[model samples]
Target: MKYSIRNILNSRSKANGNFFMEITKILGHKPKNTSIYKKAFTHRSMNIKDSEGNAINYERLEFLGDAMLSAVIASHLYLEVPSGDEGYLTKMRSKVVSREHLNELGKELNLLSLVESKIPSGQFGENIHGNLFEALVGAIFLDRGYKHCEKFIYKRVIIPYVDIETLEGKVISYKSLLIEWCQKEKKTFDYNVYEDTGNDDVRHFSVKLSIDEKVVSKARATSKKKAEEKASKRAFFAFQNRISQFK
Candidate 1:
């Protein structure tokens, strides 16, 4: 007895019912291509390969989704804020699509619950949720095109969450503001970062923030960027009154 292609497809369809239901609940729409959704949730640790021998995982989709998200957000900001200059629009888009914000959005939706992976979710970092969210966006784009993807973003992101007036005052990075203030005030500022190769399980970086050639603040974190930013934030608070006058 030989099974037809239709029979194989039907079997797969039956197996994917639960996944489709979960996706529908999250997306507020039924997924057109279930395979795309599968790839969205597939972790690199699974090491699965497609018929073409290419790795089946979310990383590539995450990259595509990130670009798509930026484009959609930029377009929306452009149309809504007709008076906003390039810098203003760019900053607004950054606030909307920031990694921290994306992570929060993913967590709110409990996107991790749908992930298919060999590694335990507890072993994953906070960024995993954000990454998975991006992958899902990419899958949506591939399965339904830009218009549908935009609709999804607008419904899931823009409608309930975005408030332009509130976002204008929001500080995406206090460190960036501090650096700009230092530059404007003609005060020499530098971040001295060095690797902390100590006995700790996670490798870290230490940062010393120097203003006018004097050490003002210091911090340490798992990443050099984060350590430097933390040091800058500390320096900013110490000189808040002085810095506020610059702008």
Candidate 2:
């Protein structure tokens, strides 16, 4: 067979073209600077660097996107919930942009498929999906501006999921909820977390939630936070009757 150098280059060009189309569809507009979008999907493990020798990855964009989400959501809550006080508005915004919700958003968009990472995508934690989604939003803000970013947030987040009643009951932090309940009733609560690696290859943690020195619940998970949350959730259900009275 004859060597065809041009054929390989053409295939590469076509791949790039398709990637741009995918990004345009997601953003609802053509990206002005393709590099920014690329950076948004680039993982830190990839270890890319700019000509100035600065590390290039989605971390910075994630930070910007988090702020942008908070700002836009805060604005929407302010306007939509006219009677909501500072505490109410803040709580509403947190529910909307919580890590769990962001992870869902990222999964819905399948944003992880575009990430350039040295690590296998399967090995990544659930937060990576949300992290990349935030990076993409940050890229949009940088590439276009705040208006474009706000529009995307409205289309994907606010318009679809910002029902007042739904958000009011949504649990952003089960652990926080459990602690608050305990405090309200003048009960002391503690999360006794300890390492509990079993036969699994990954290390795990176990937690026992004690309320008033009584072990209310015990749970296990890959991380201390997850184990504590699991324990708290169990504890909450166990004390649901009493908690309802305080609520």
Residue 231 CA displacement from its true place in model 2, Å: 28
All candidates' TM-scores? 0.64, 0.64
Listed per model in order, the count of residue pairs whose N, CA or C atoms clash below 3 Å is 0, 0
Task: Give the alpha carbon lDDT tens digit for every residue of 174-229 in model 2.
Answer: 78887888889999988899999987799999998888998988988999989998
TM-score of 1: 0.64
What RMSD, rounded to one decimal, does every model reach? Answer: 12.1, 11.7
Error of 1 at 210 (Å): 48
Question: Best lDDT goes to which candidate?
Answer: 2
Considering summed lDDT, which 10 consecutive residues are worst modelled in model 2?
A: 238-247
Per-residue accuracy of model 1 over 148-238 as CA lDDT, tens digit each: 8887777656654455764797666758888899889999988889998587789999989999999999888899889987787667656
Query: After aligning candidate 2 to the native by TM-score, how far in Å is the CA of 137 from where it should be?
Result: 0.9
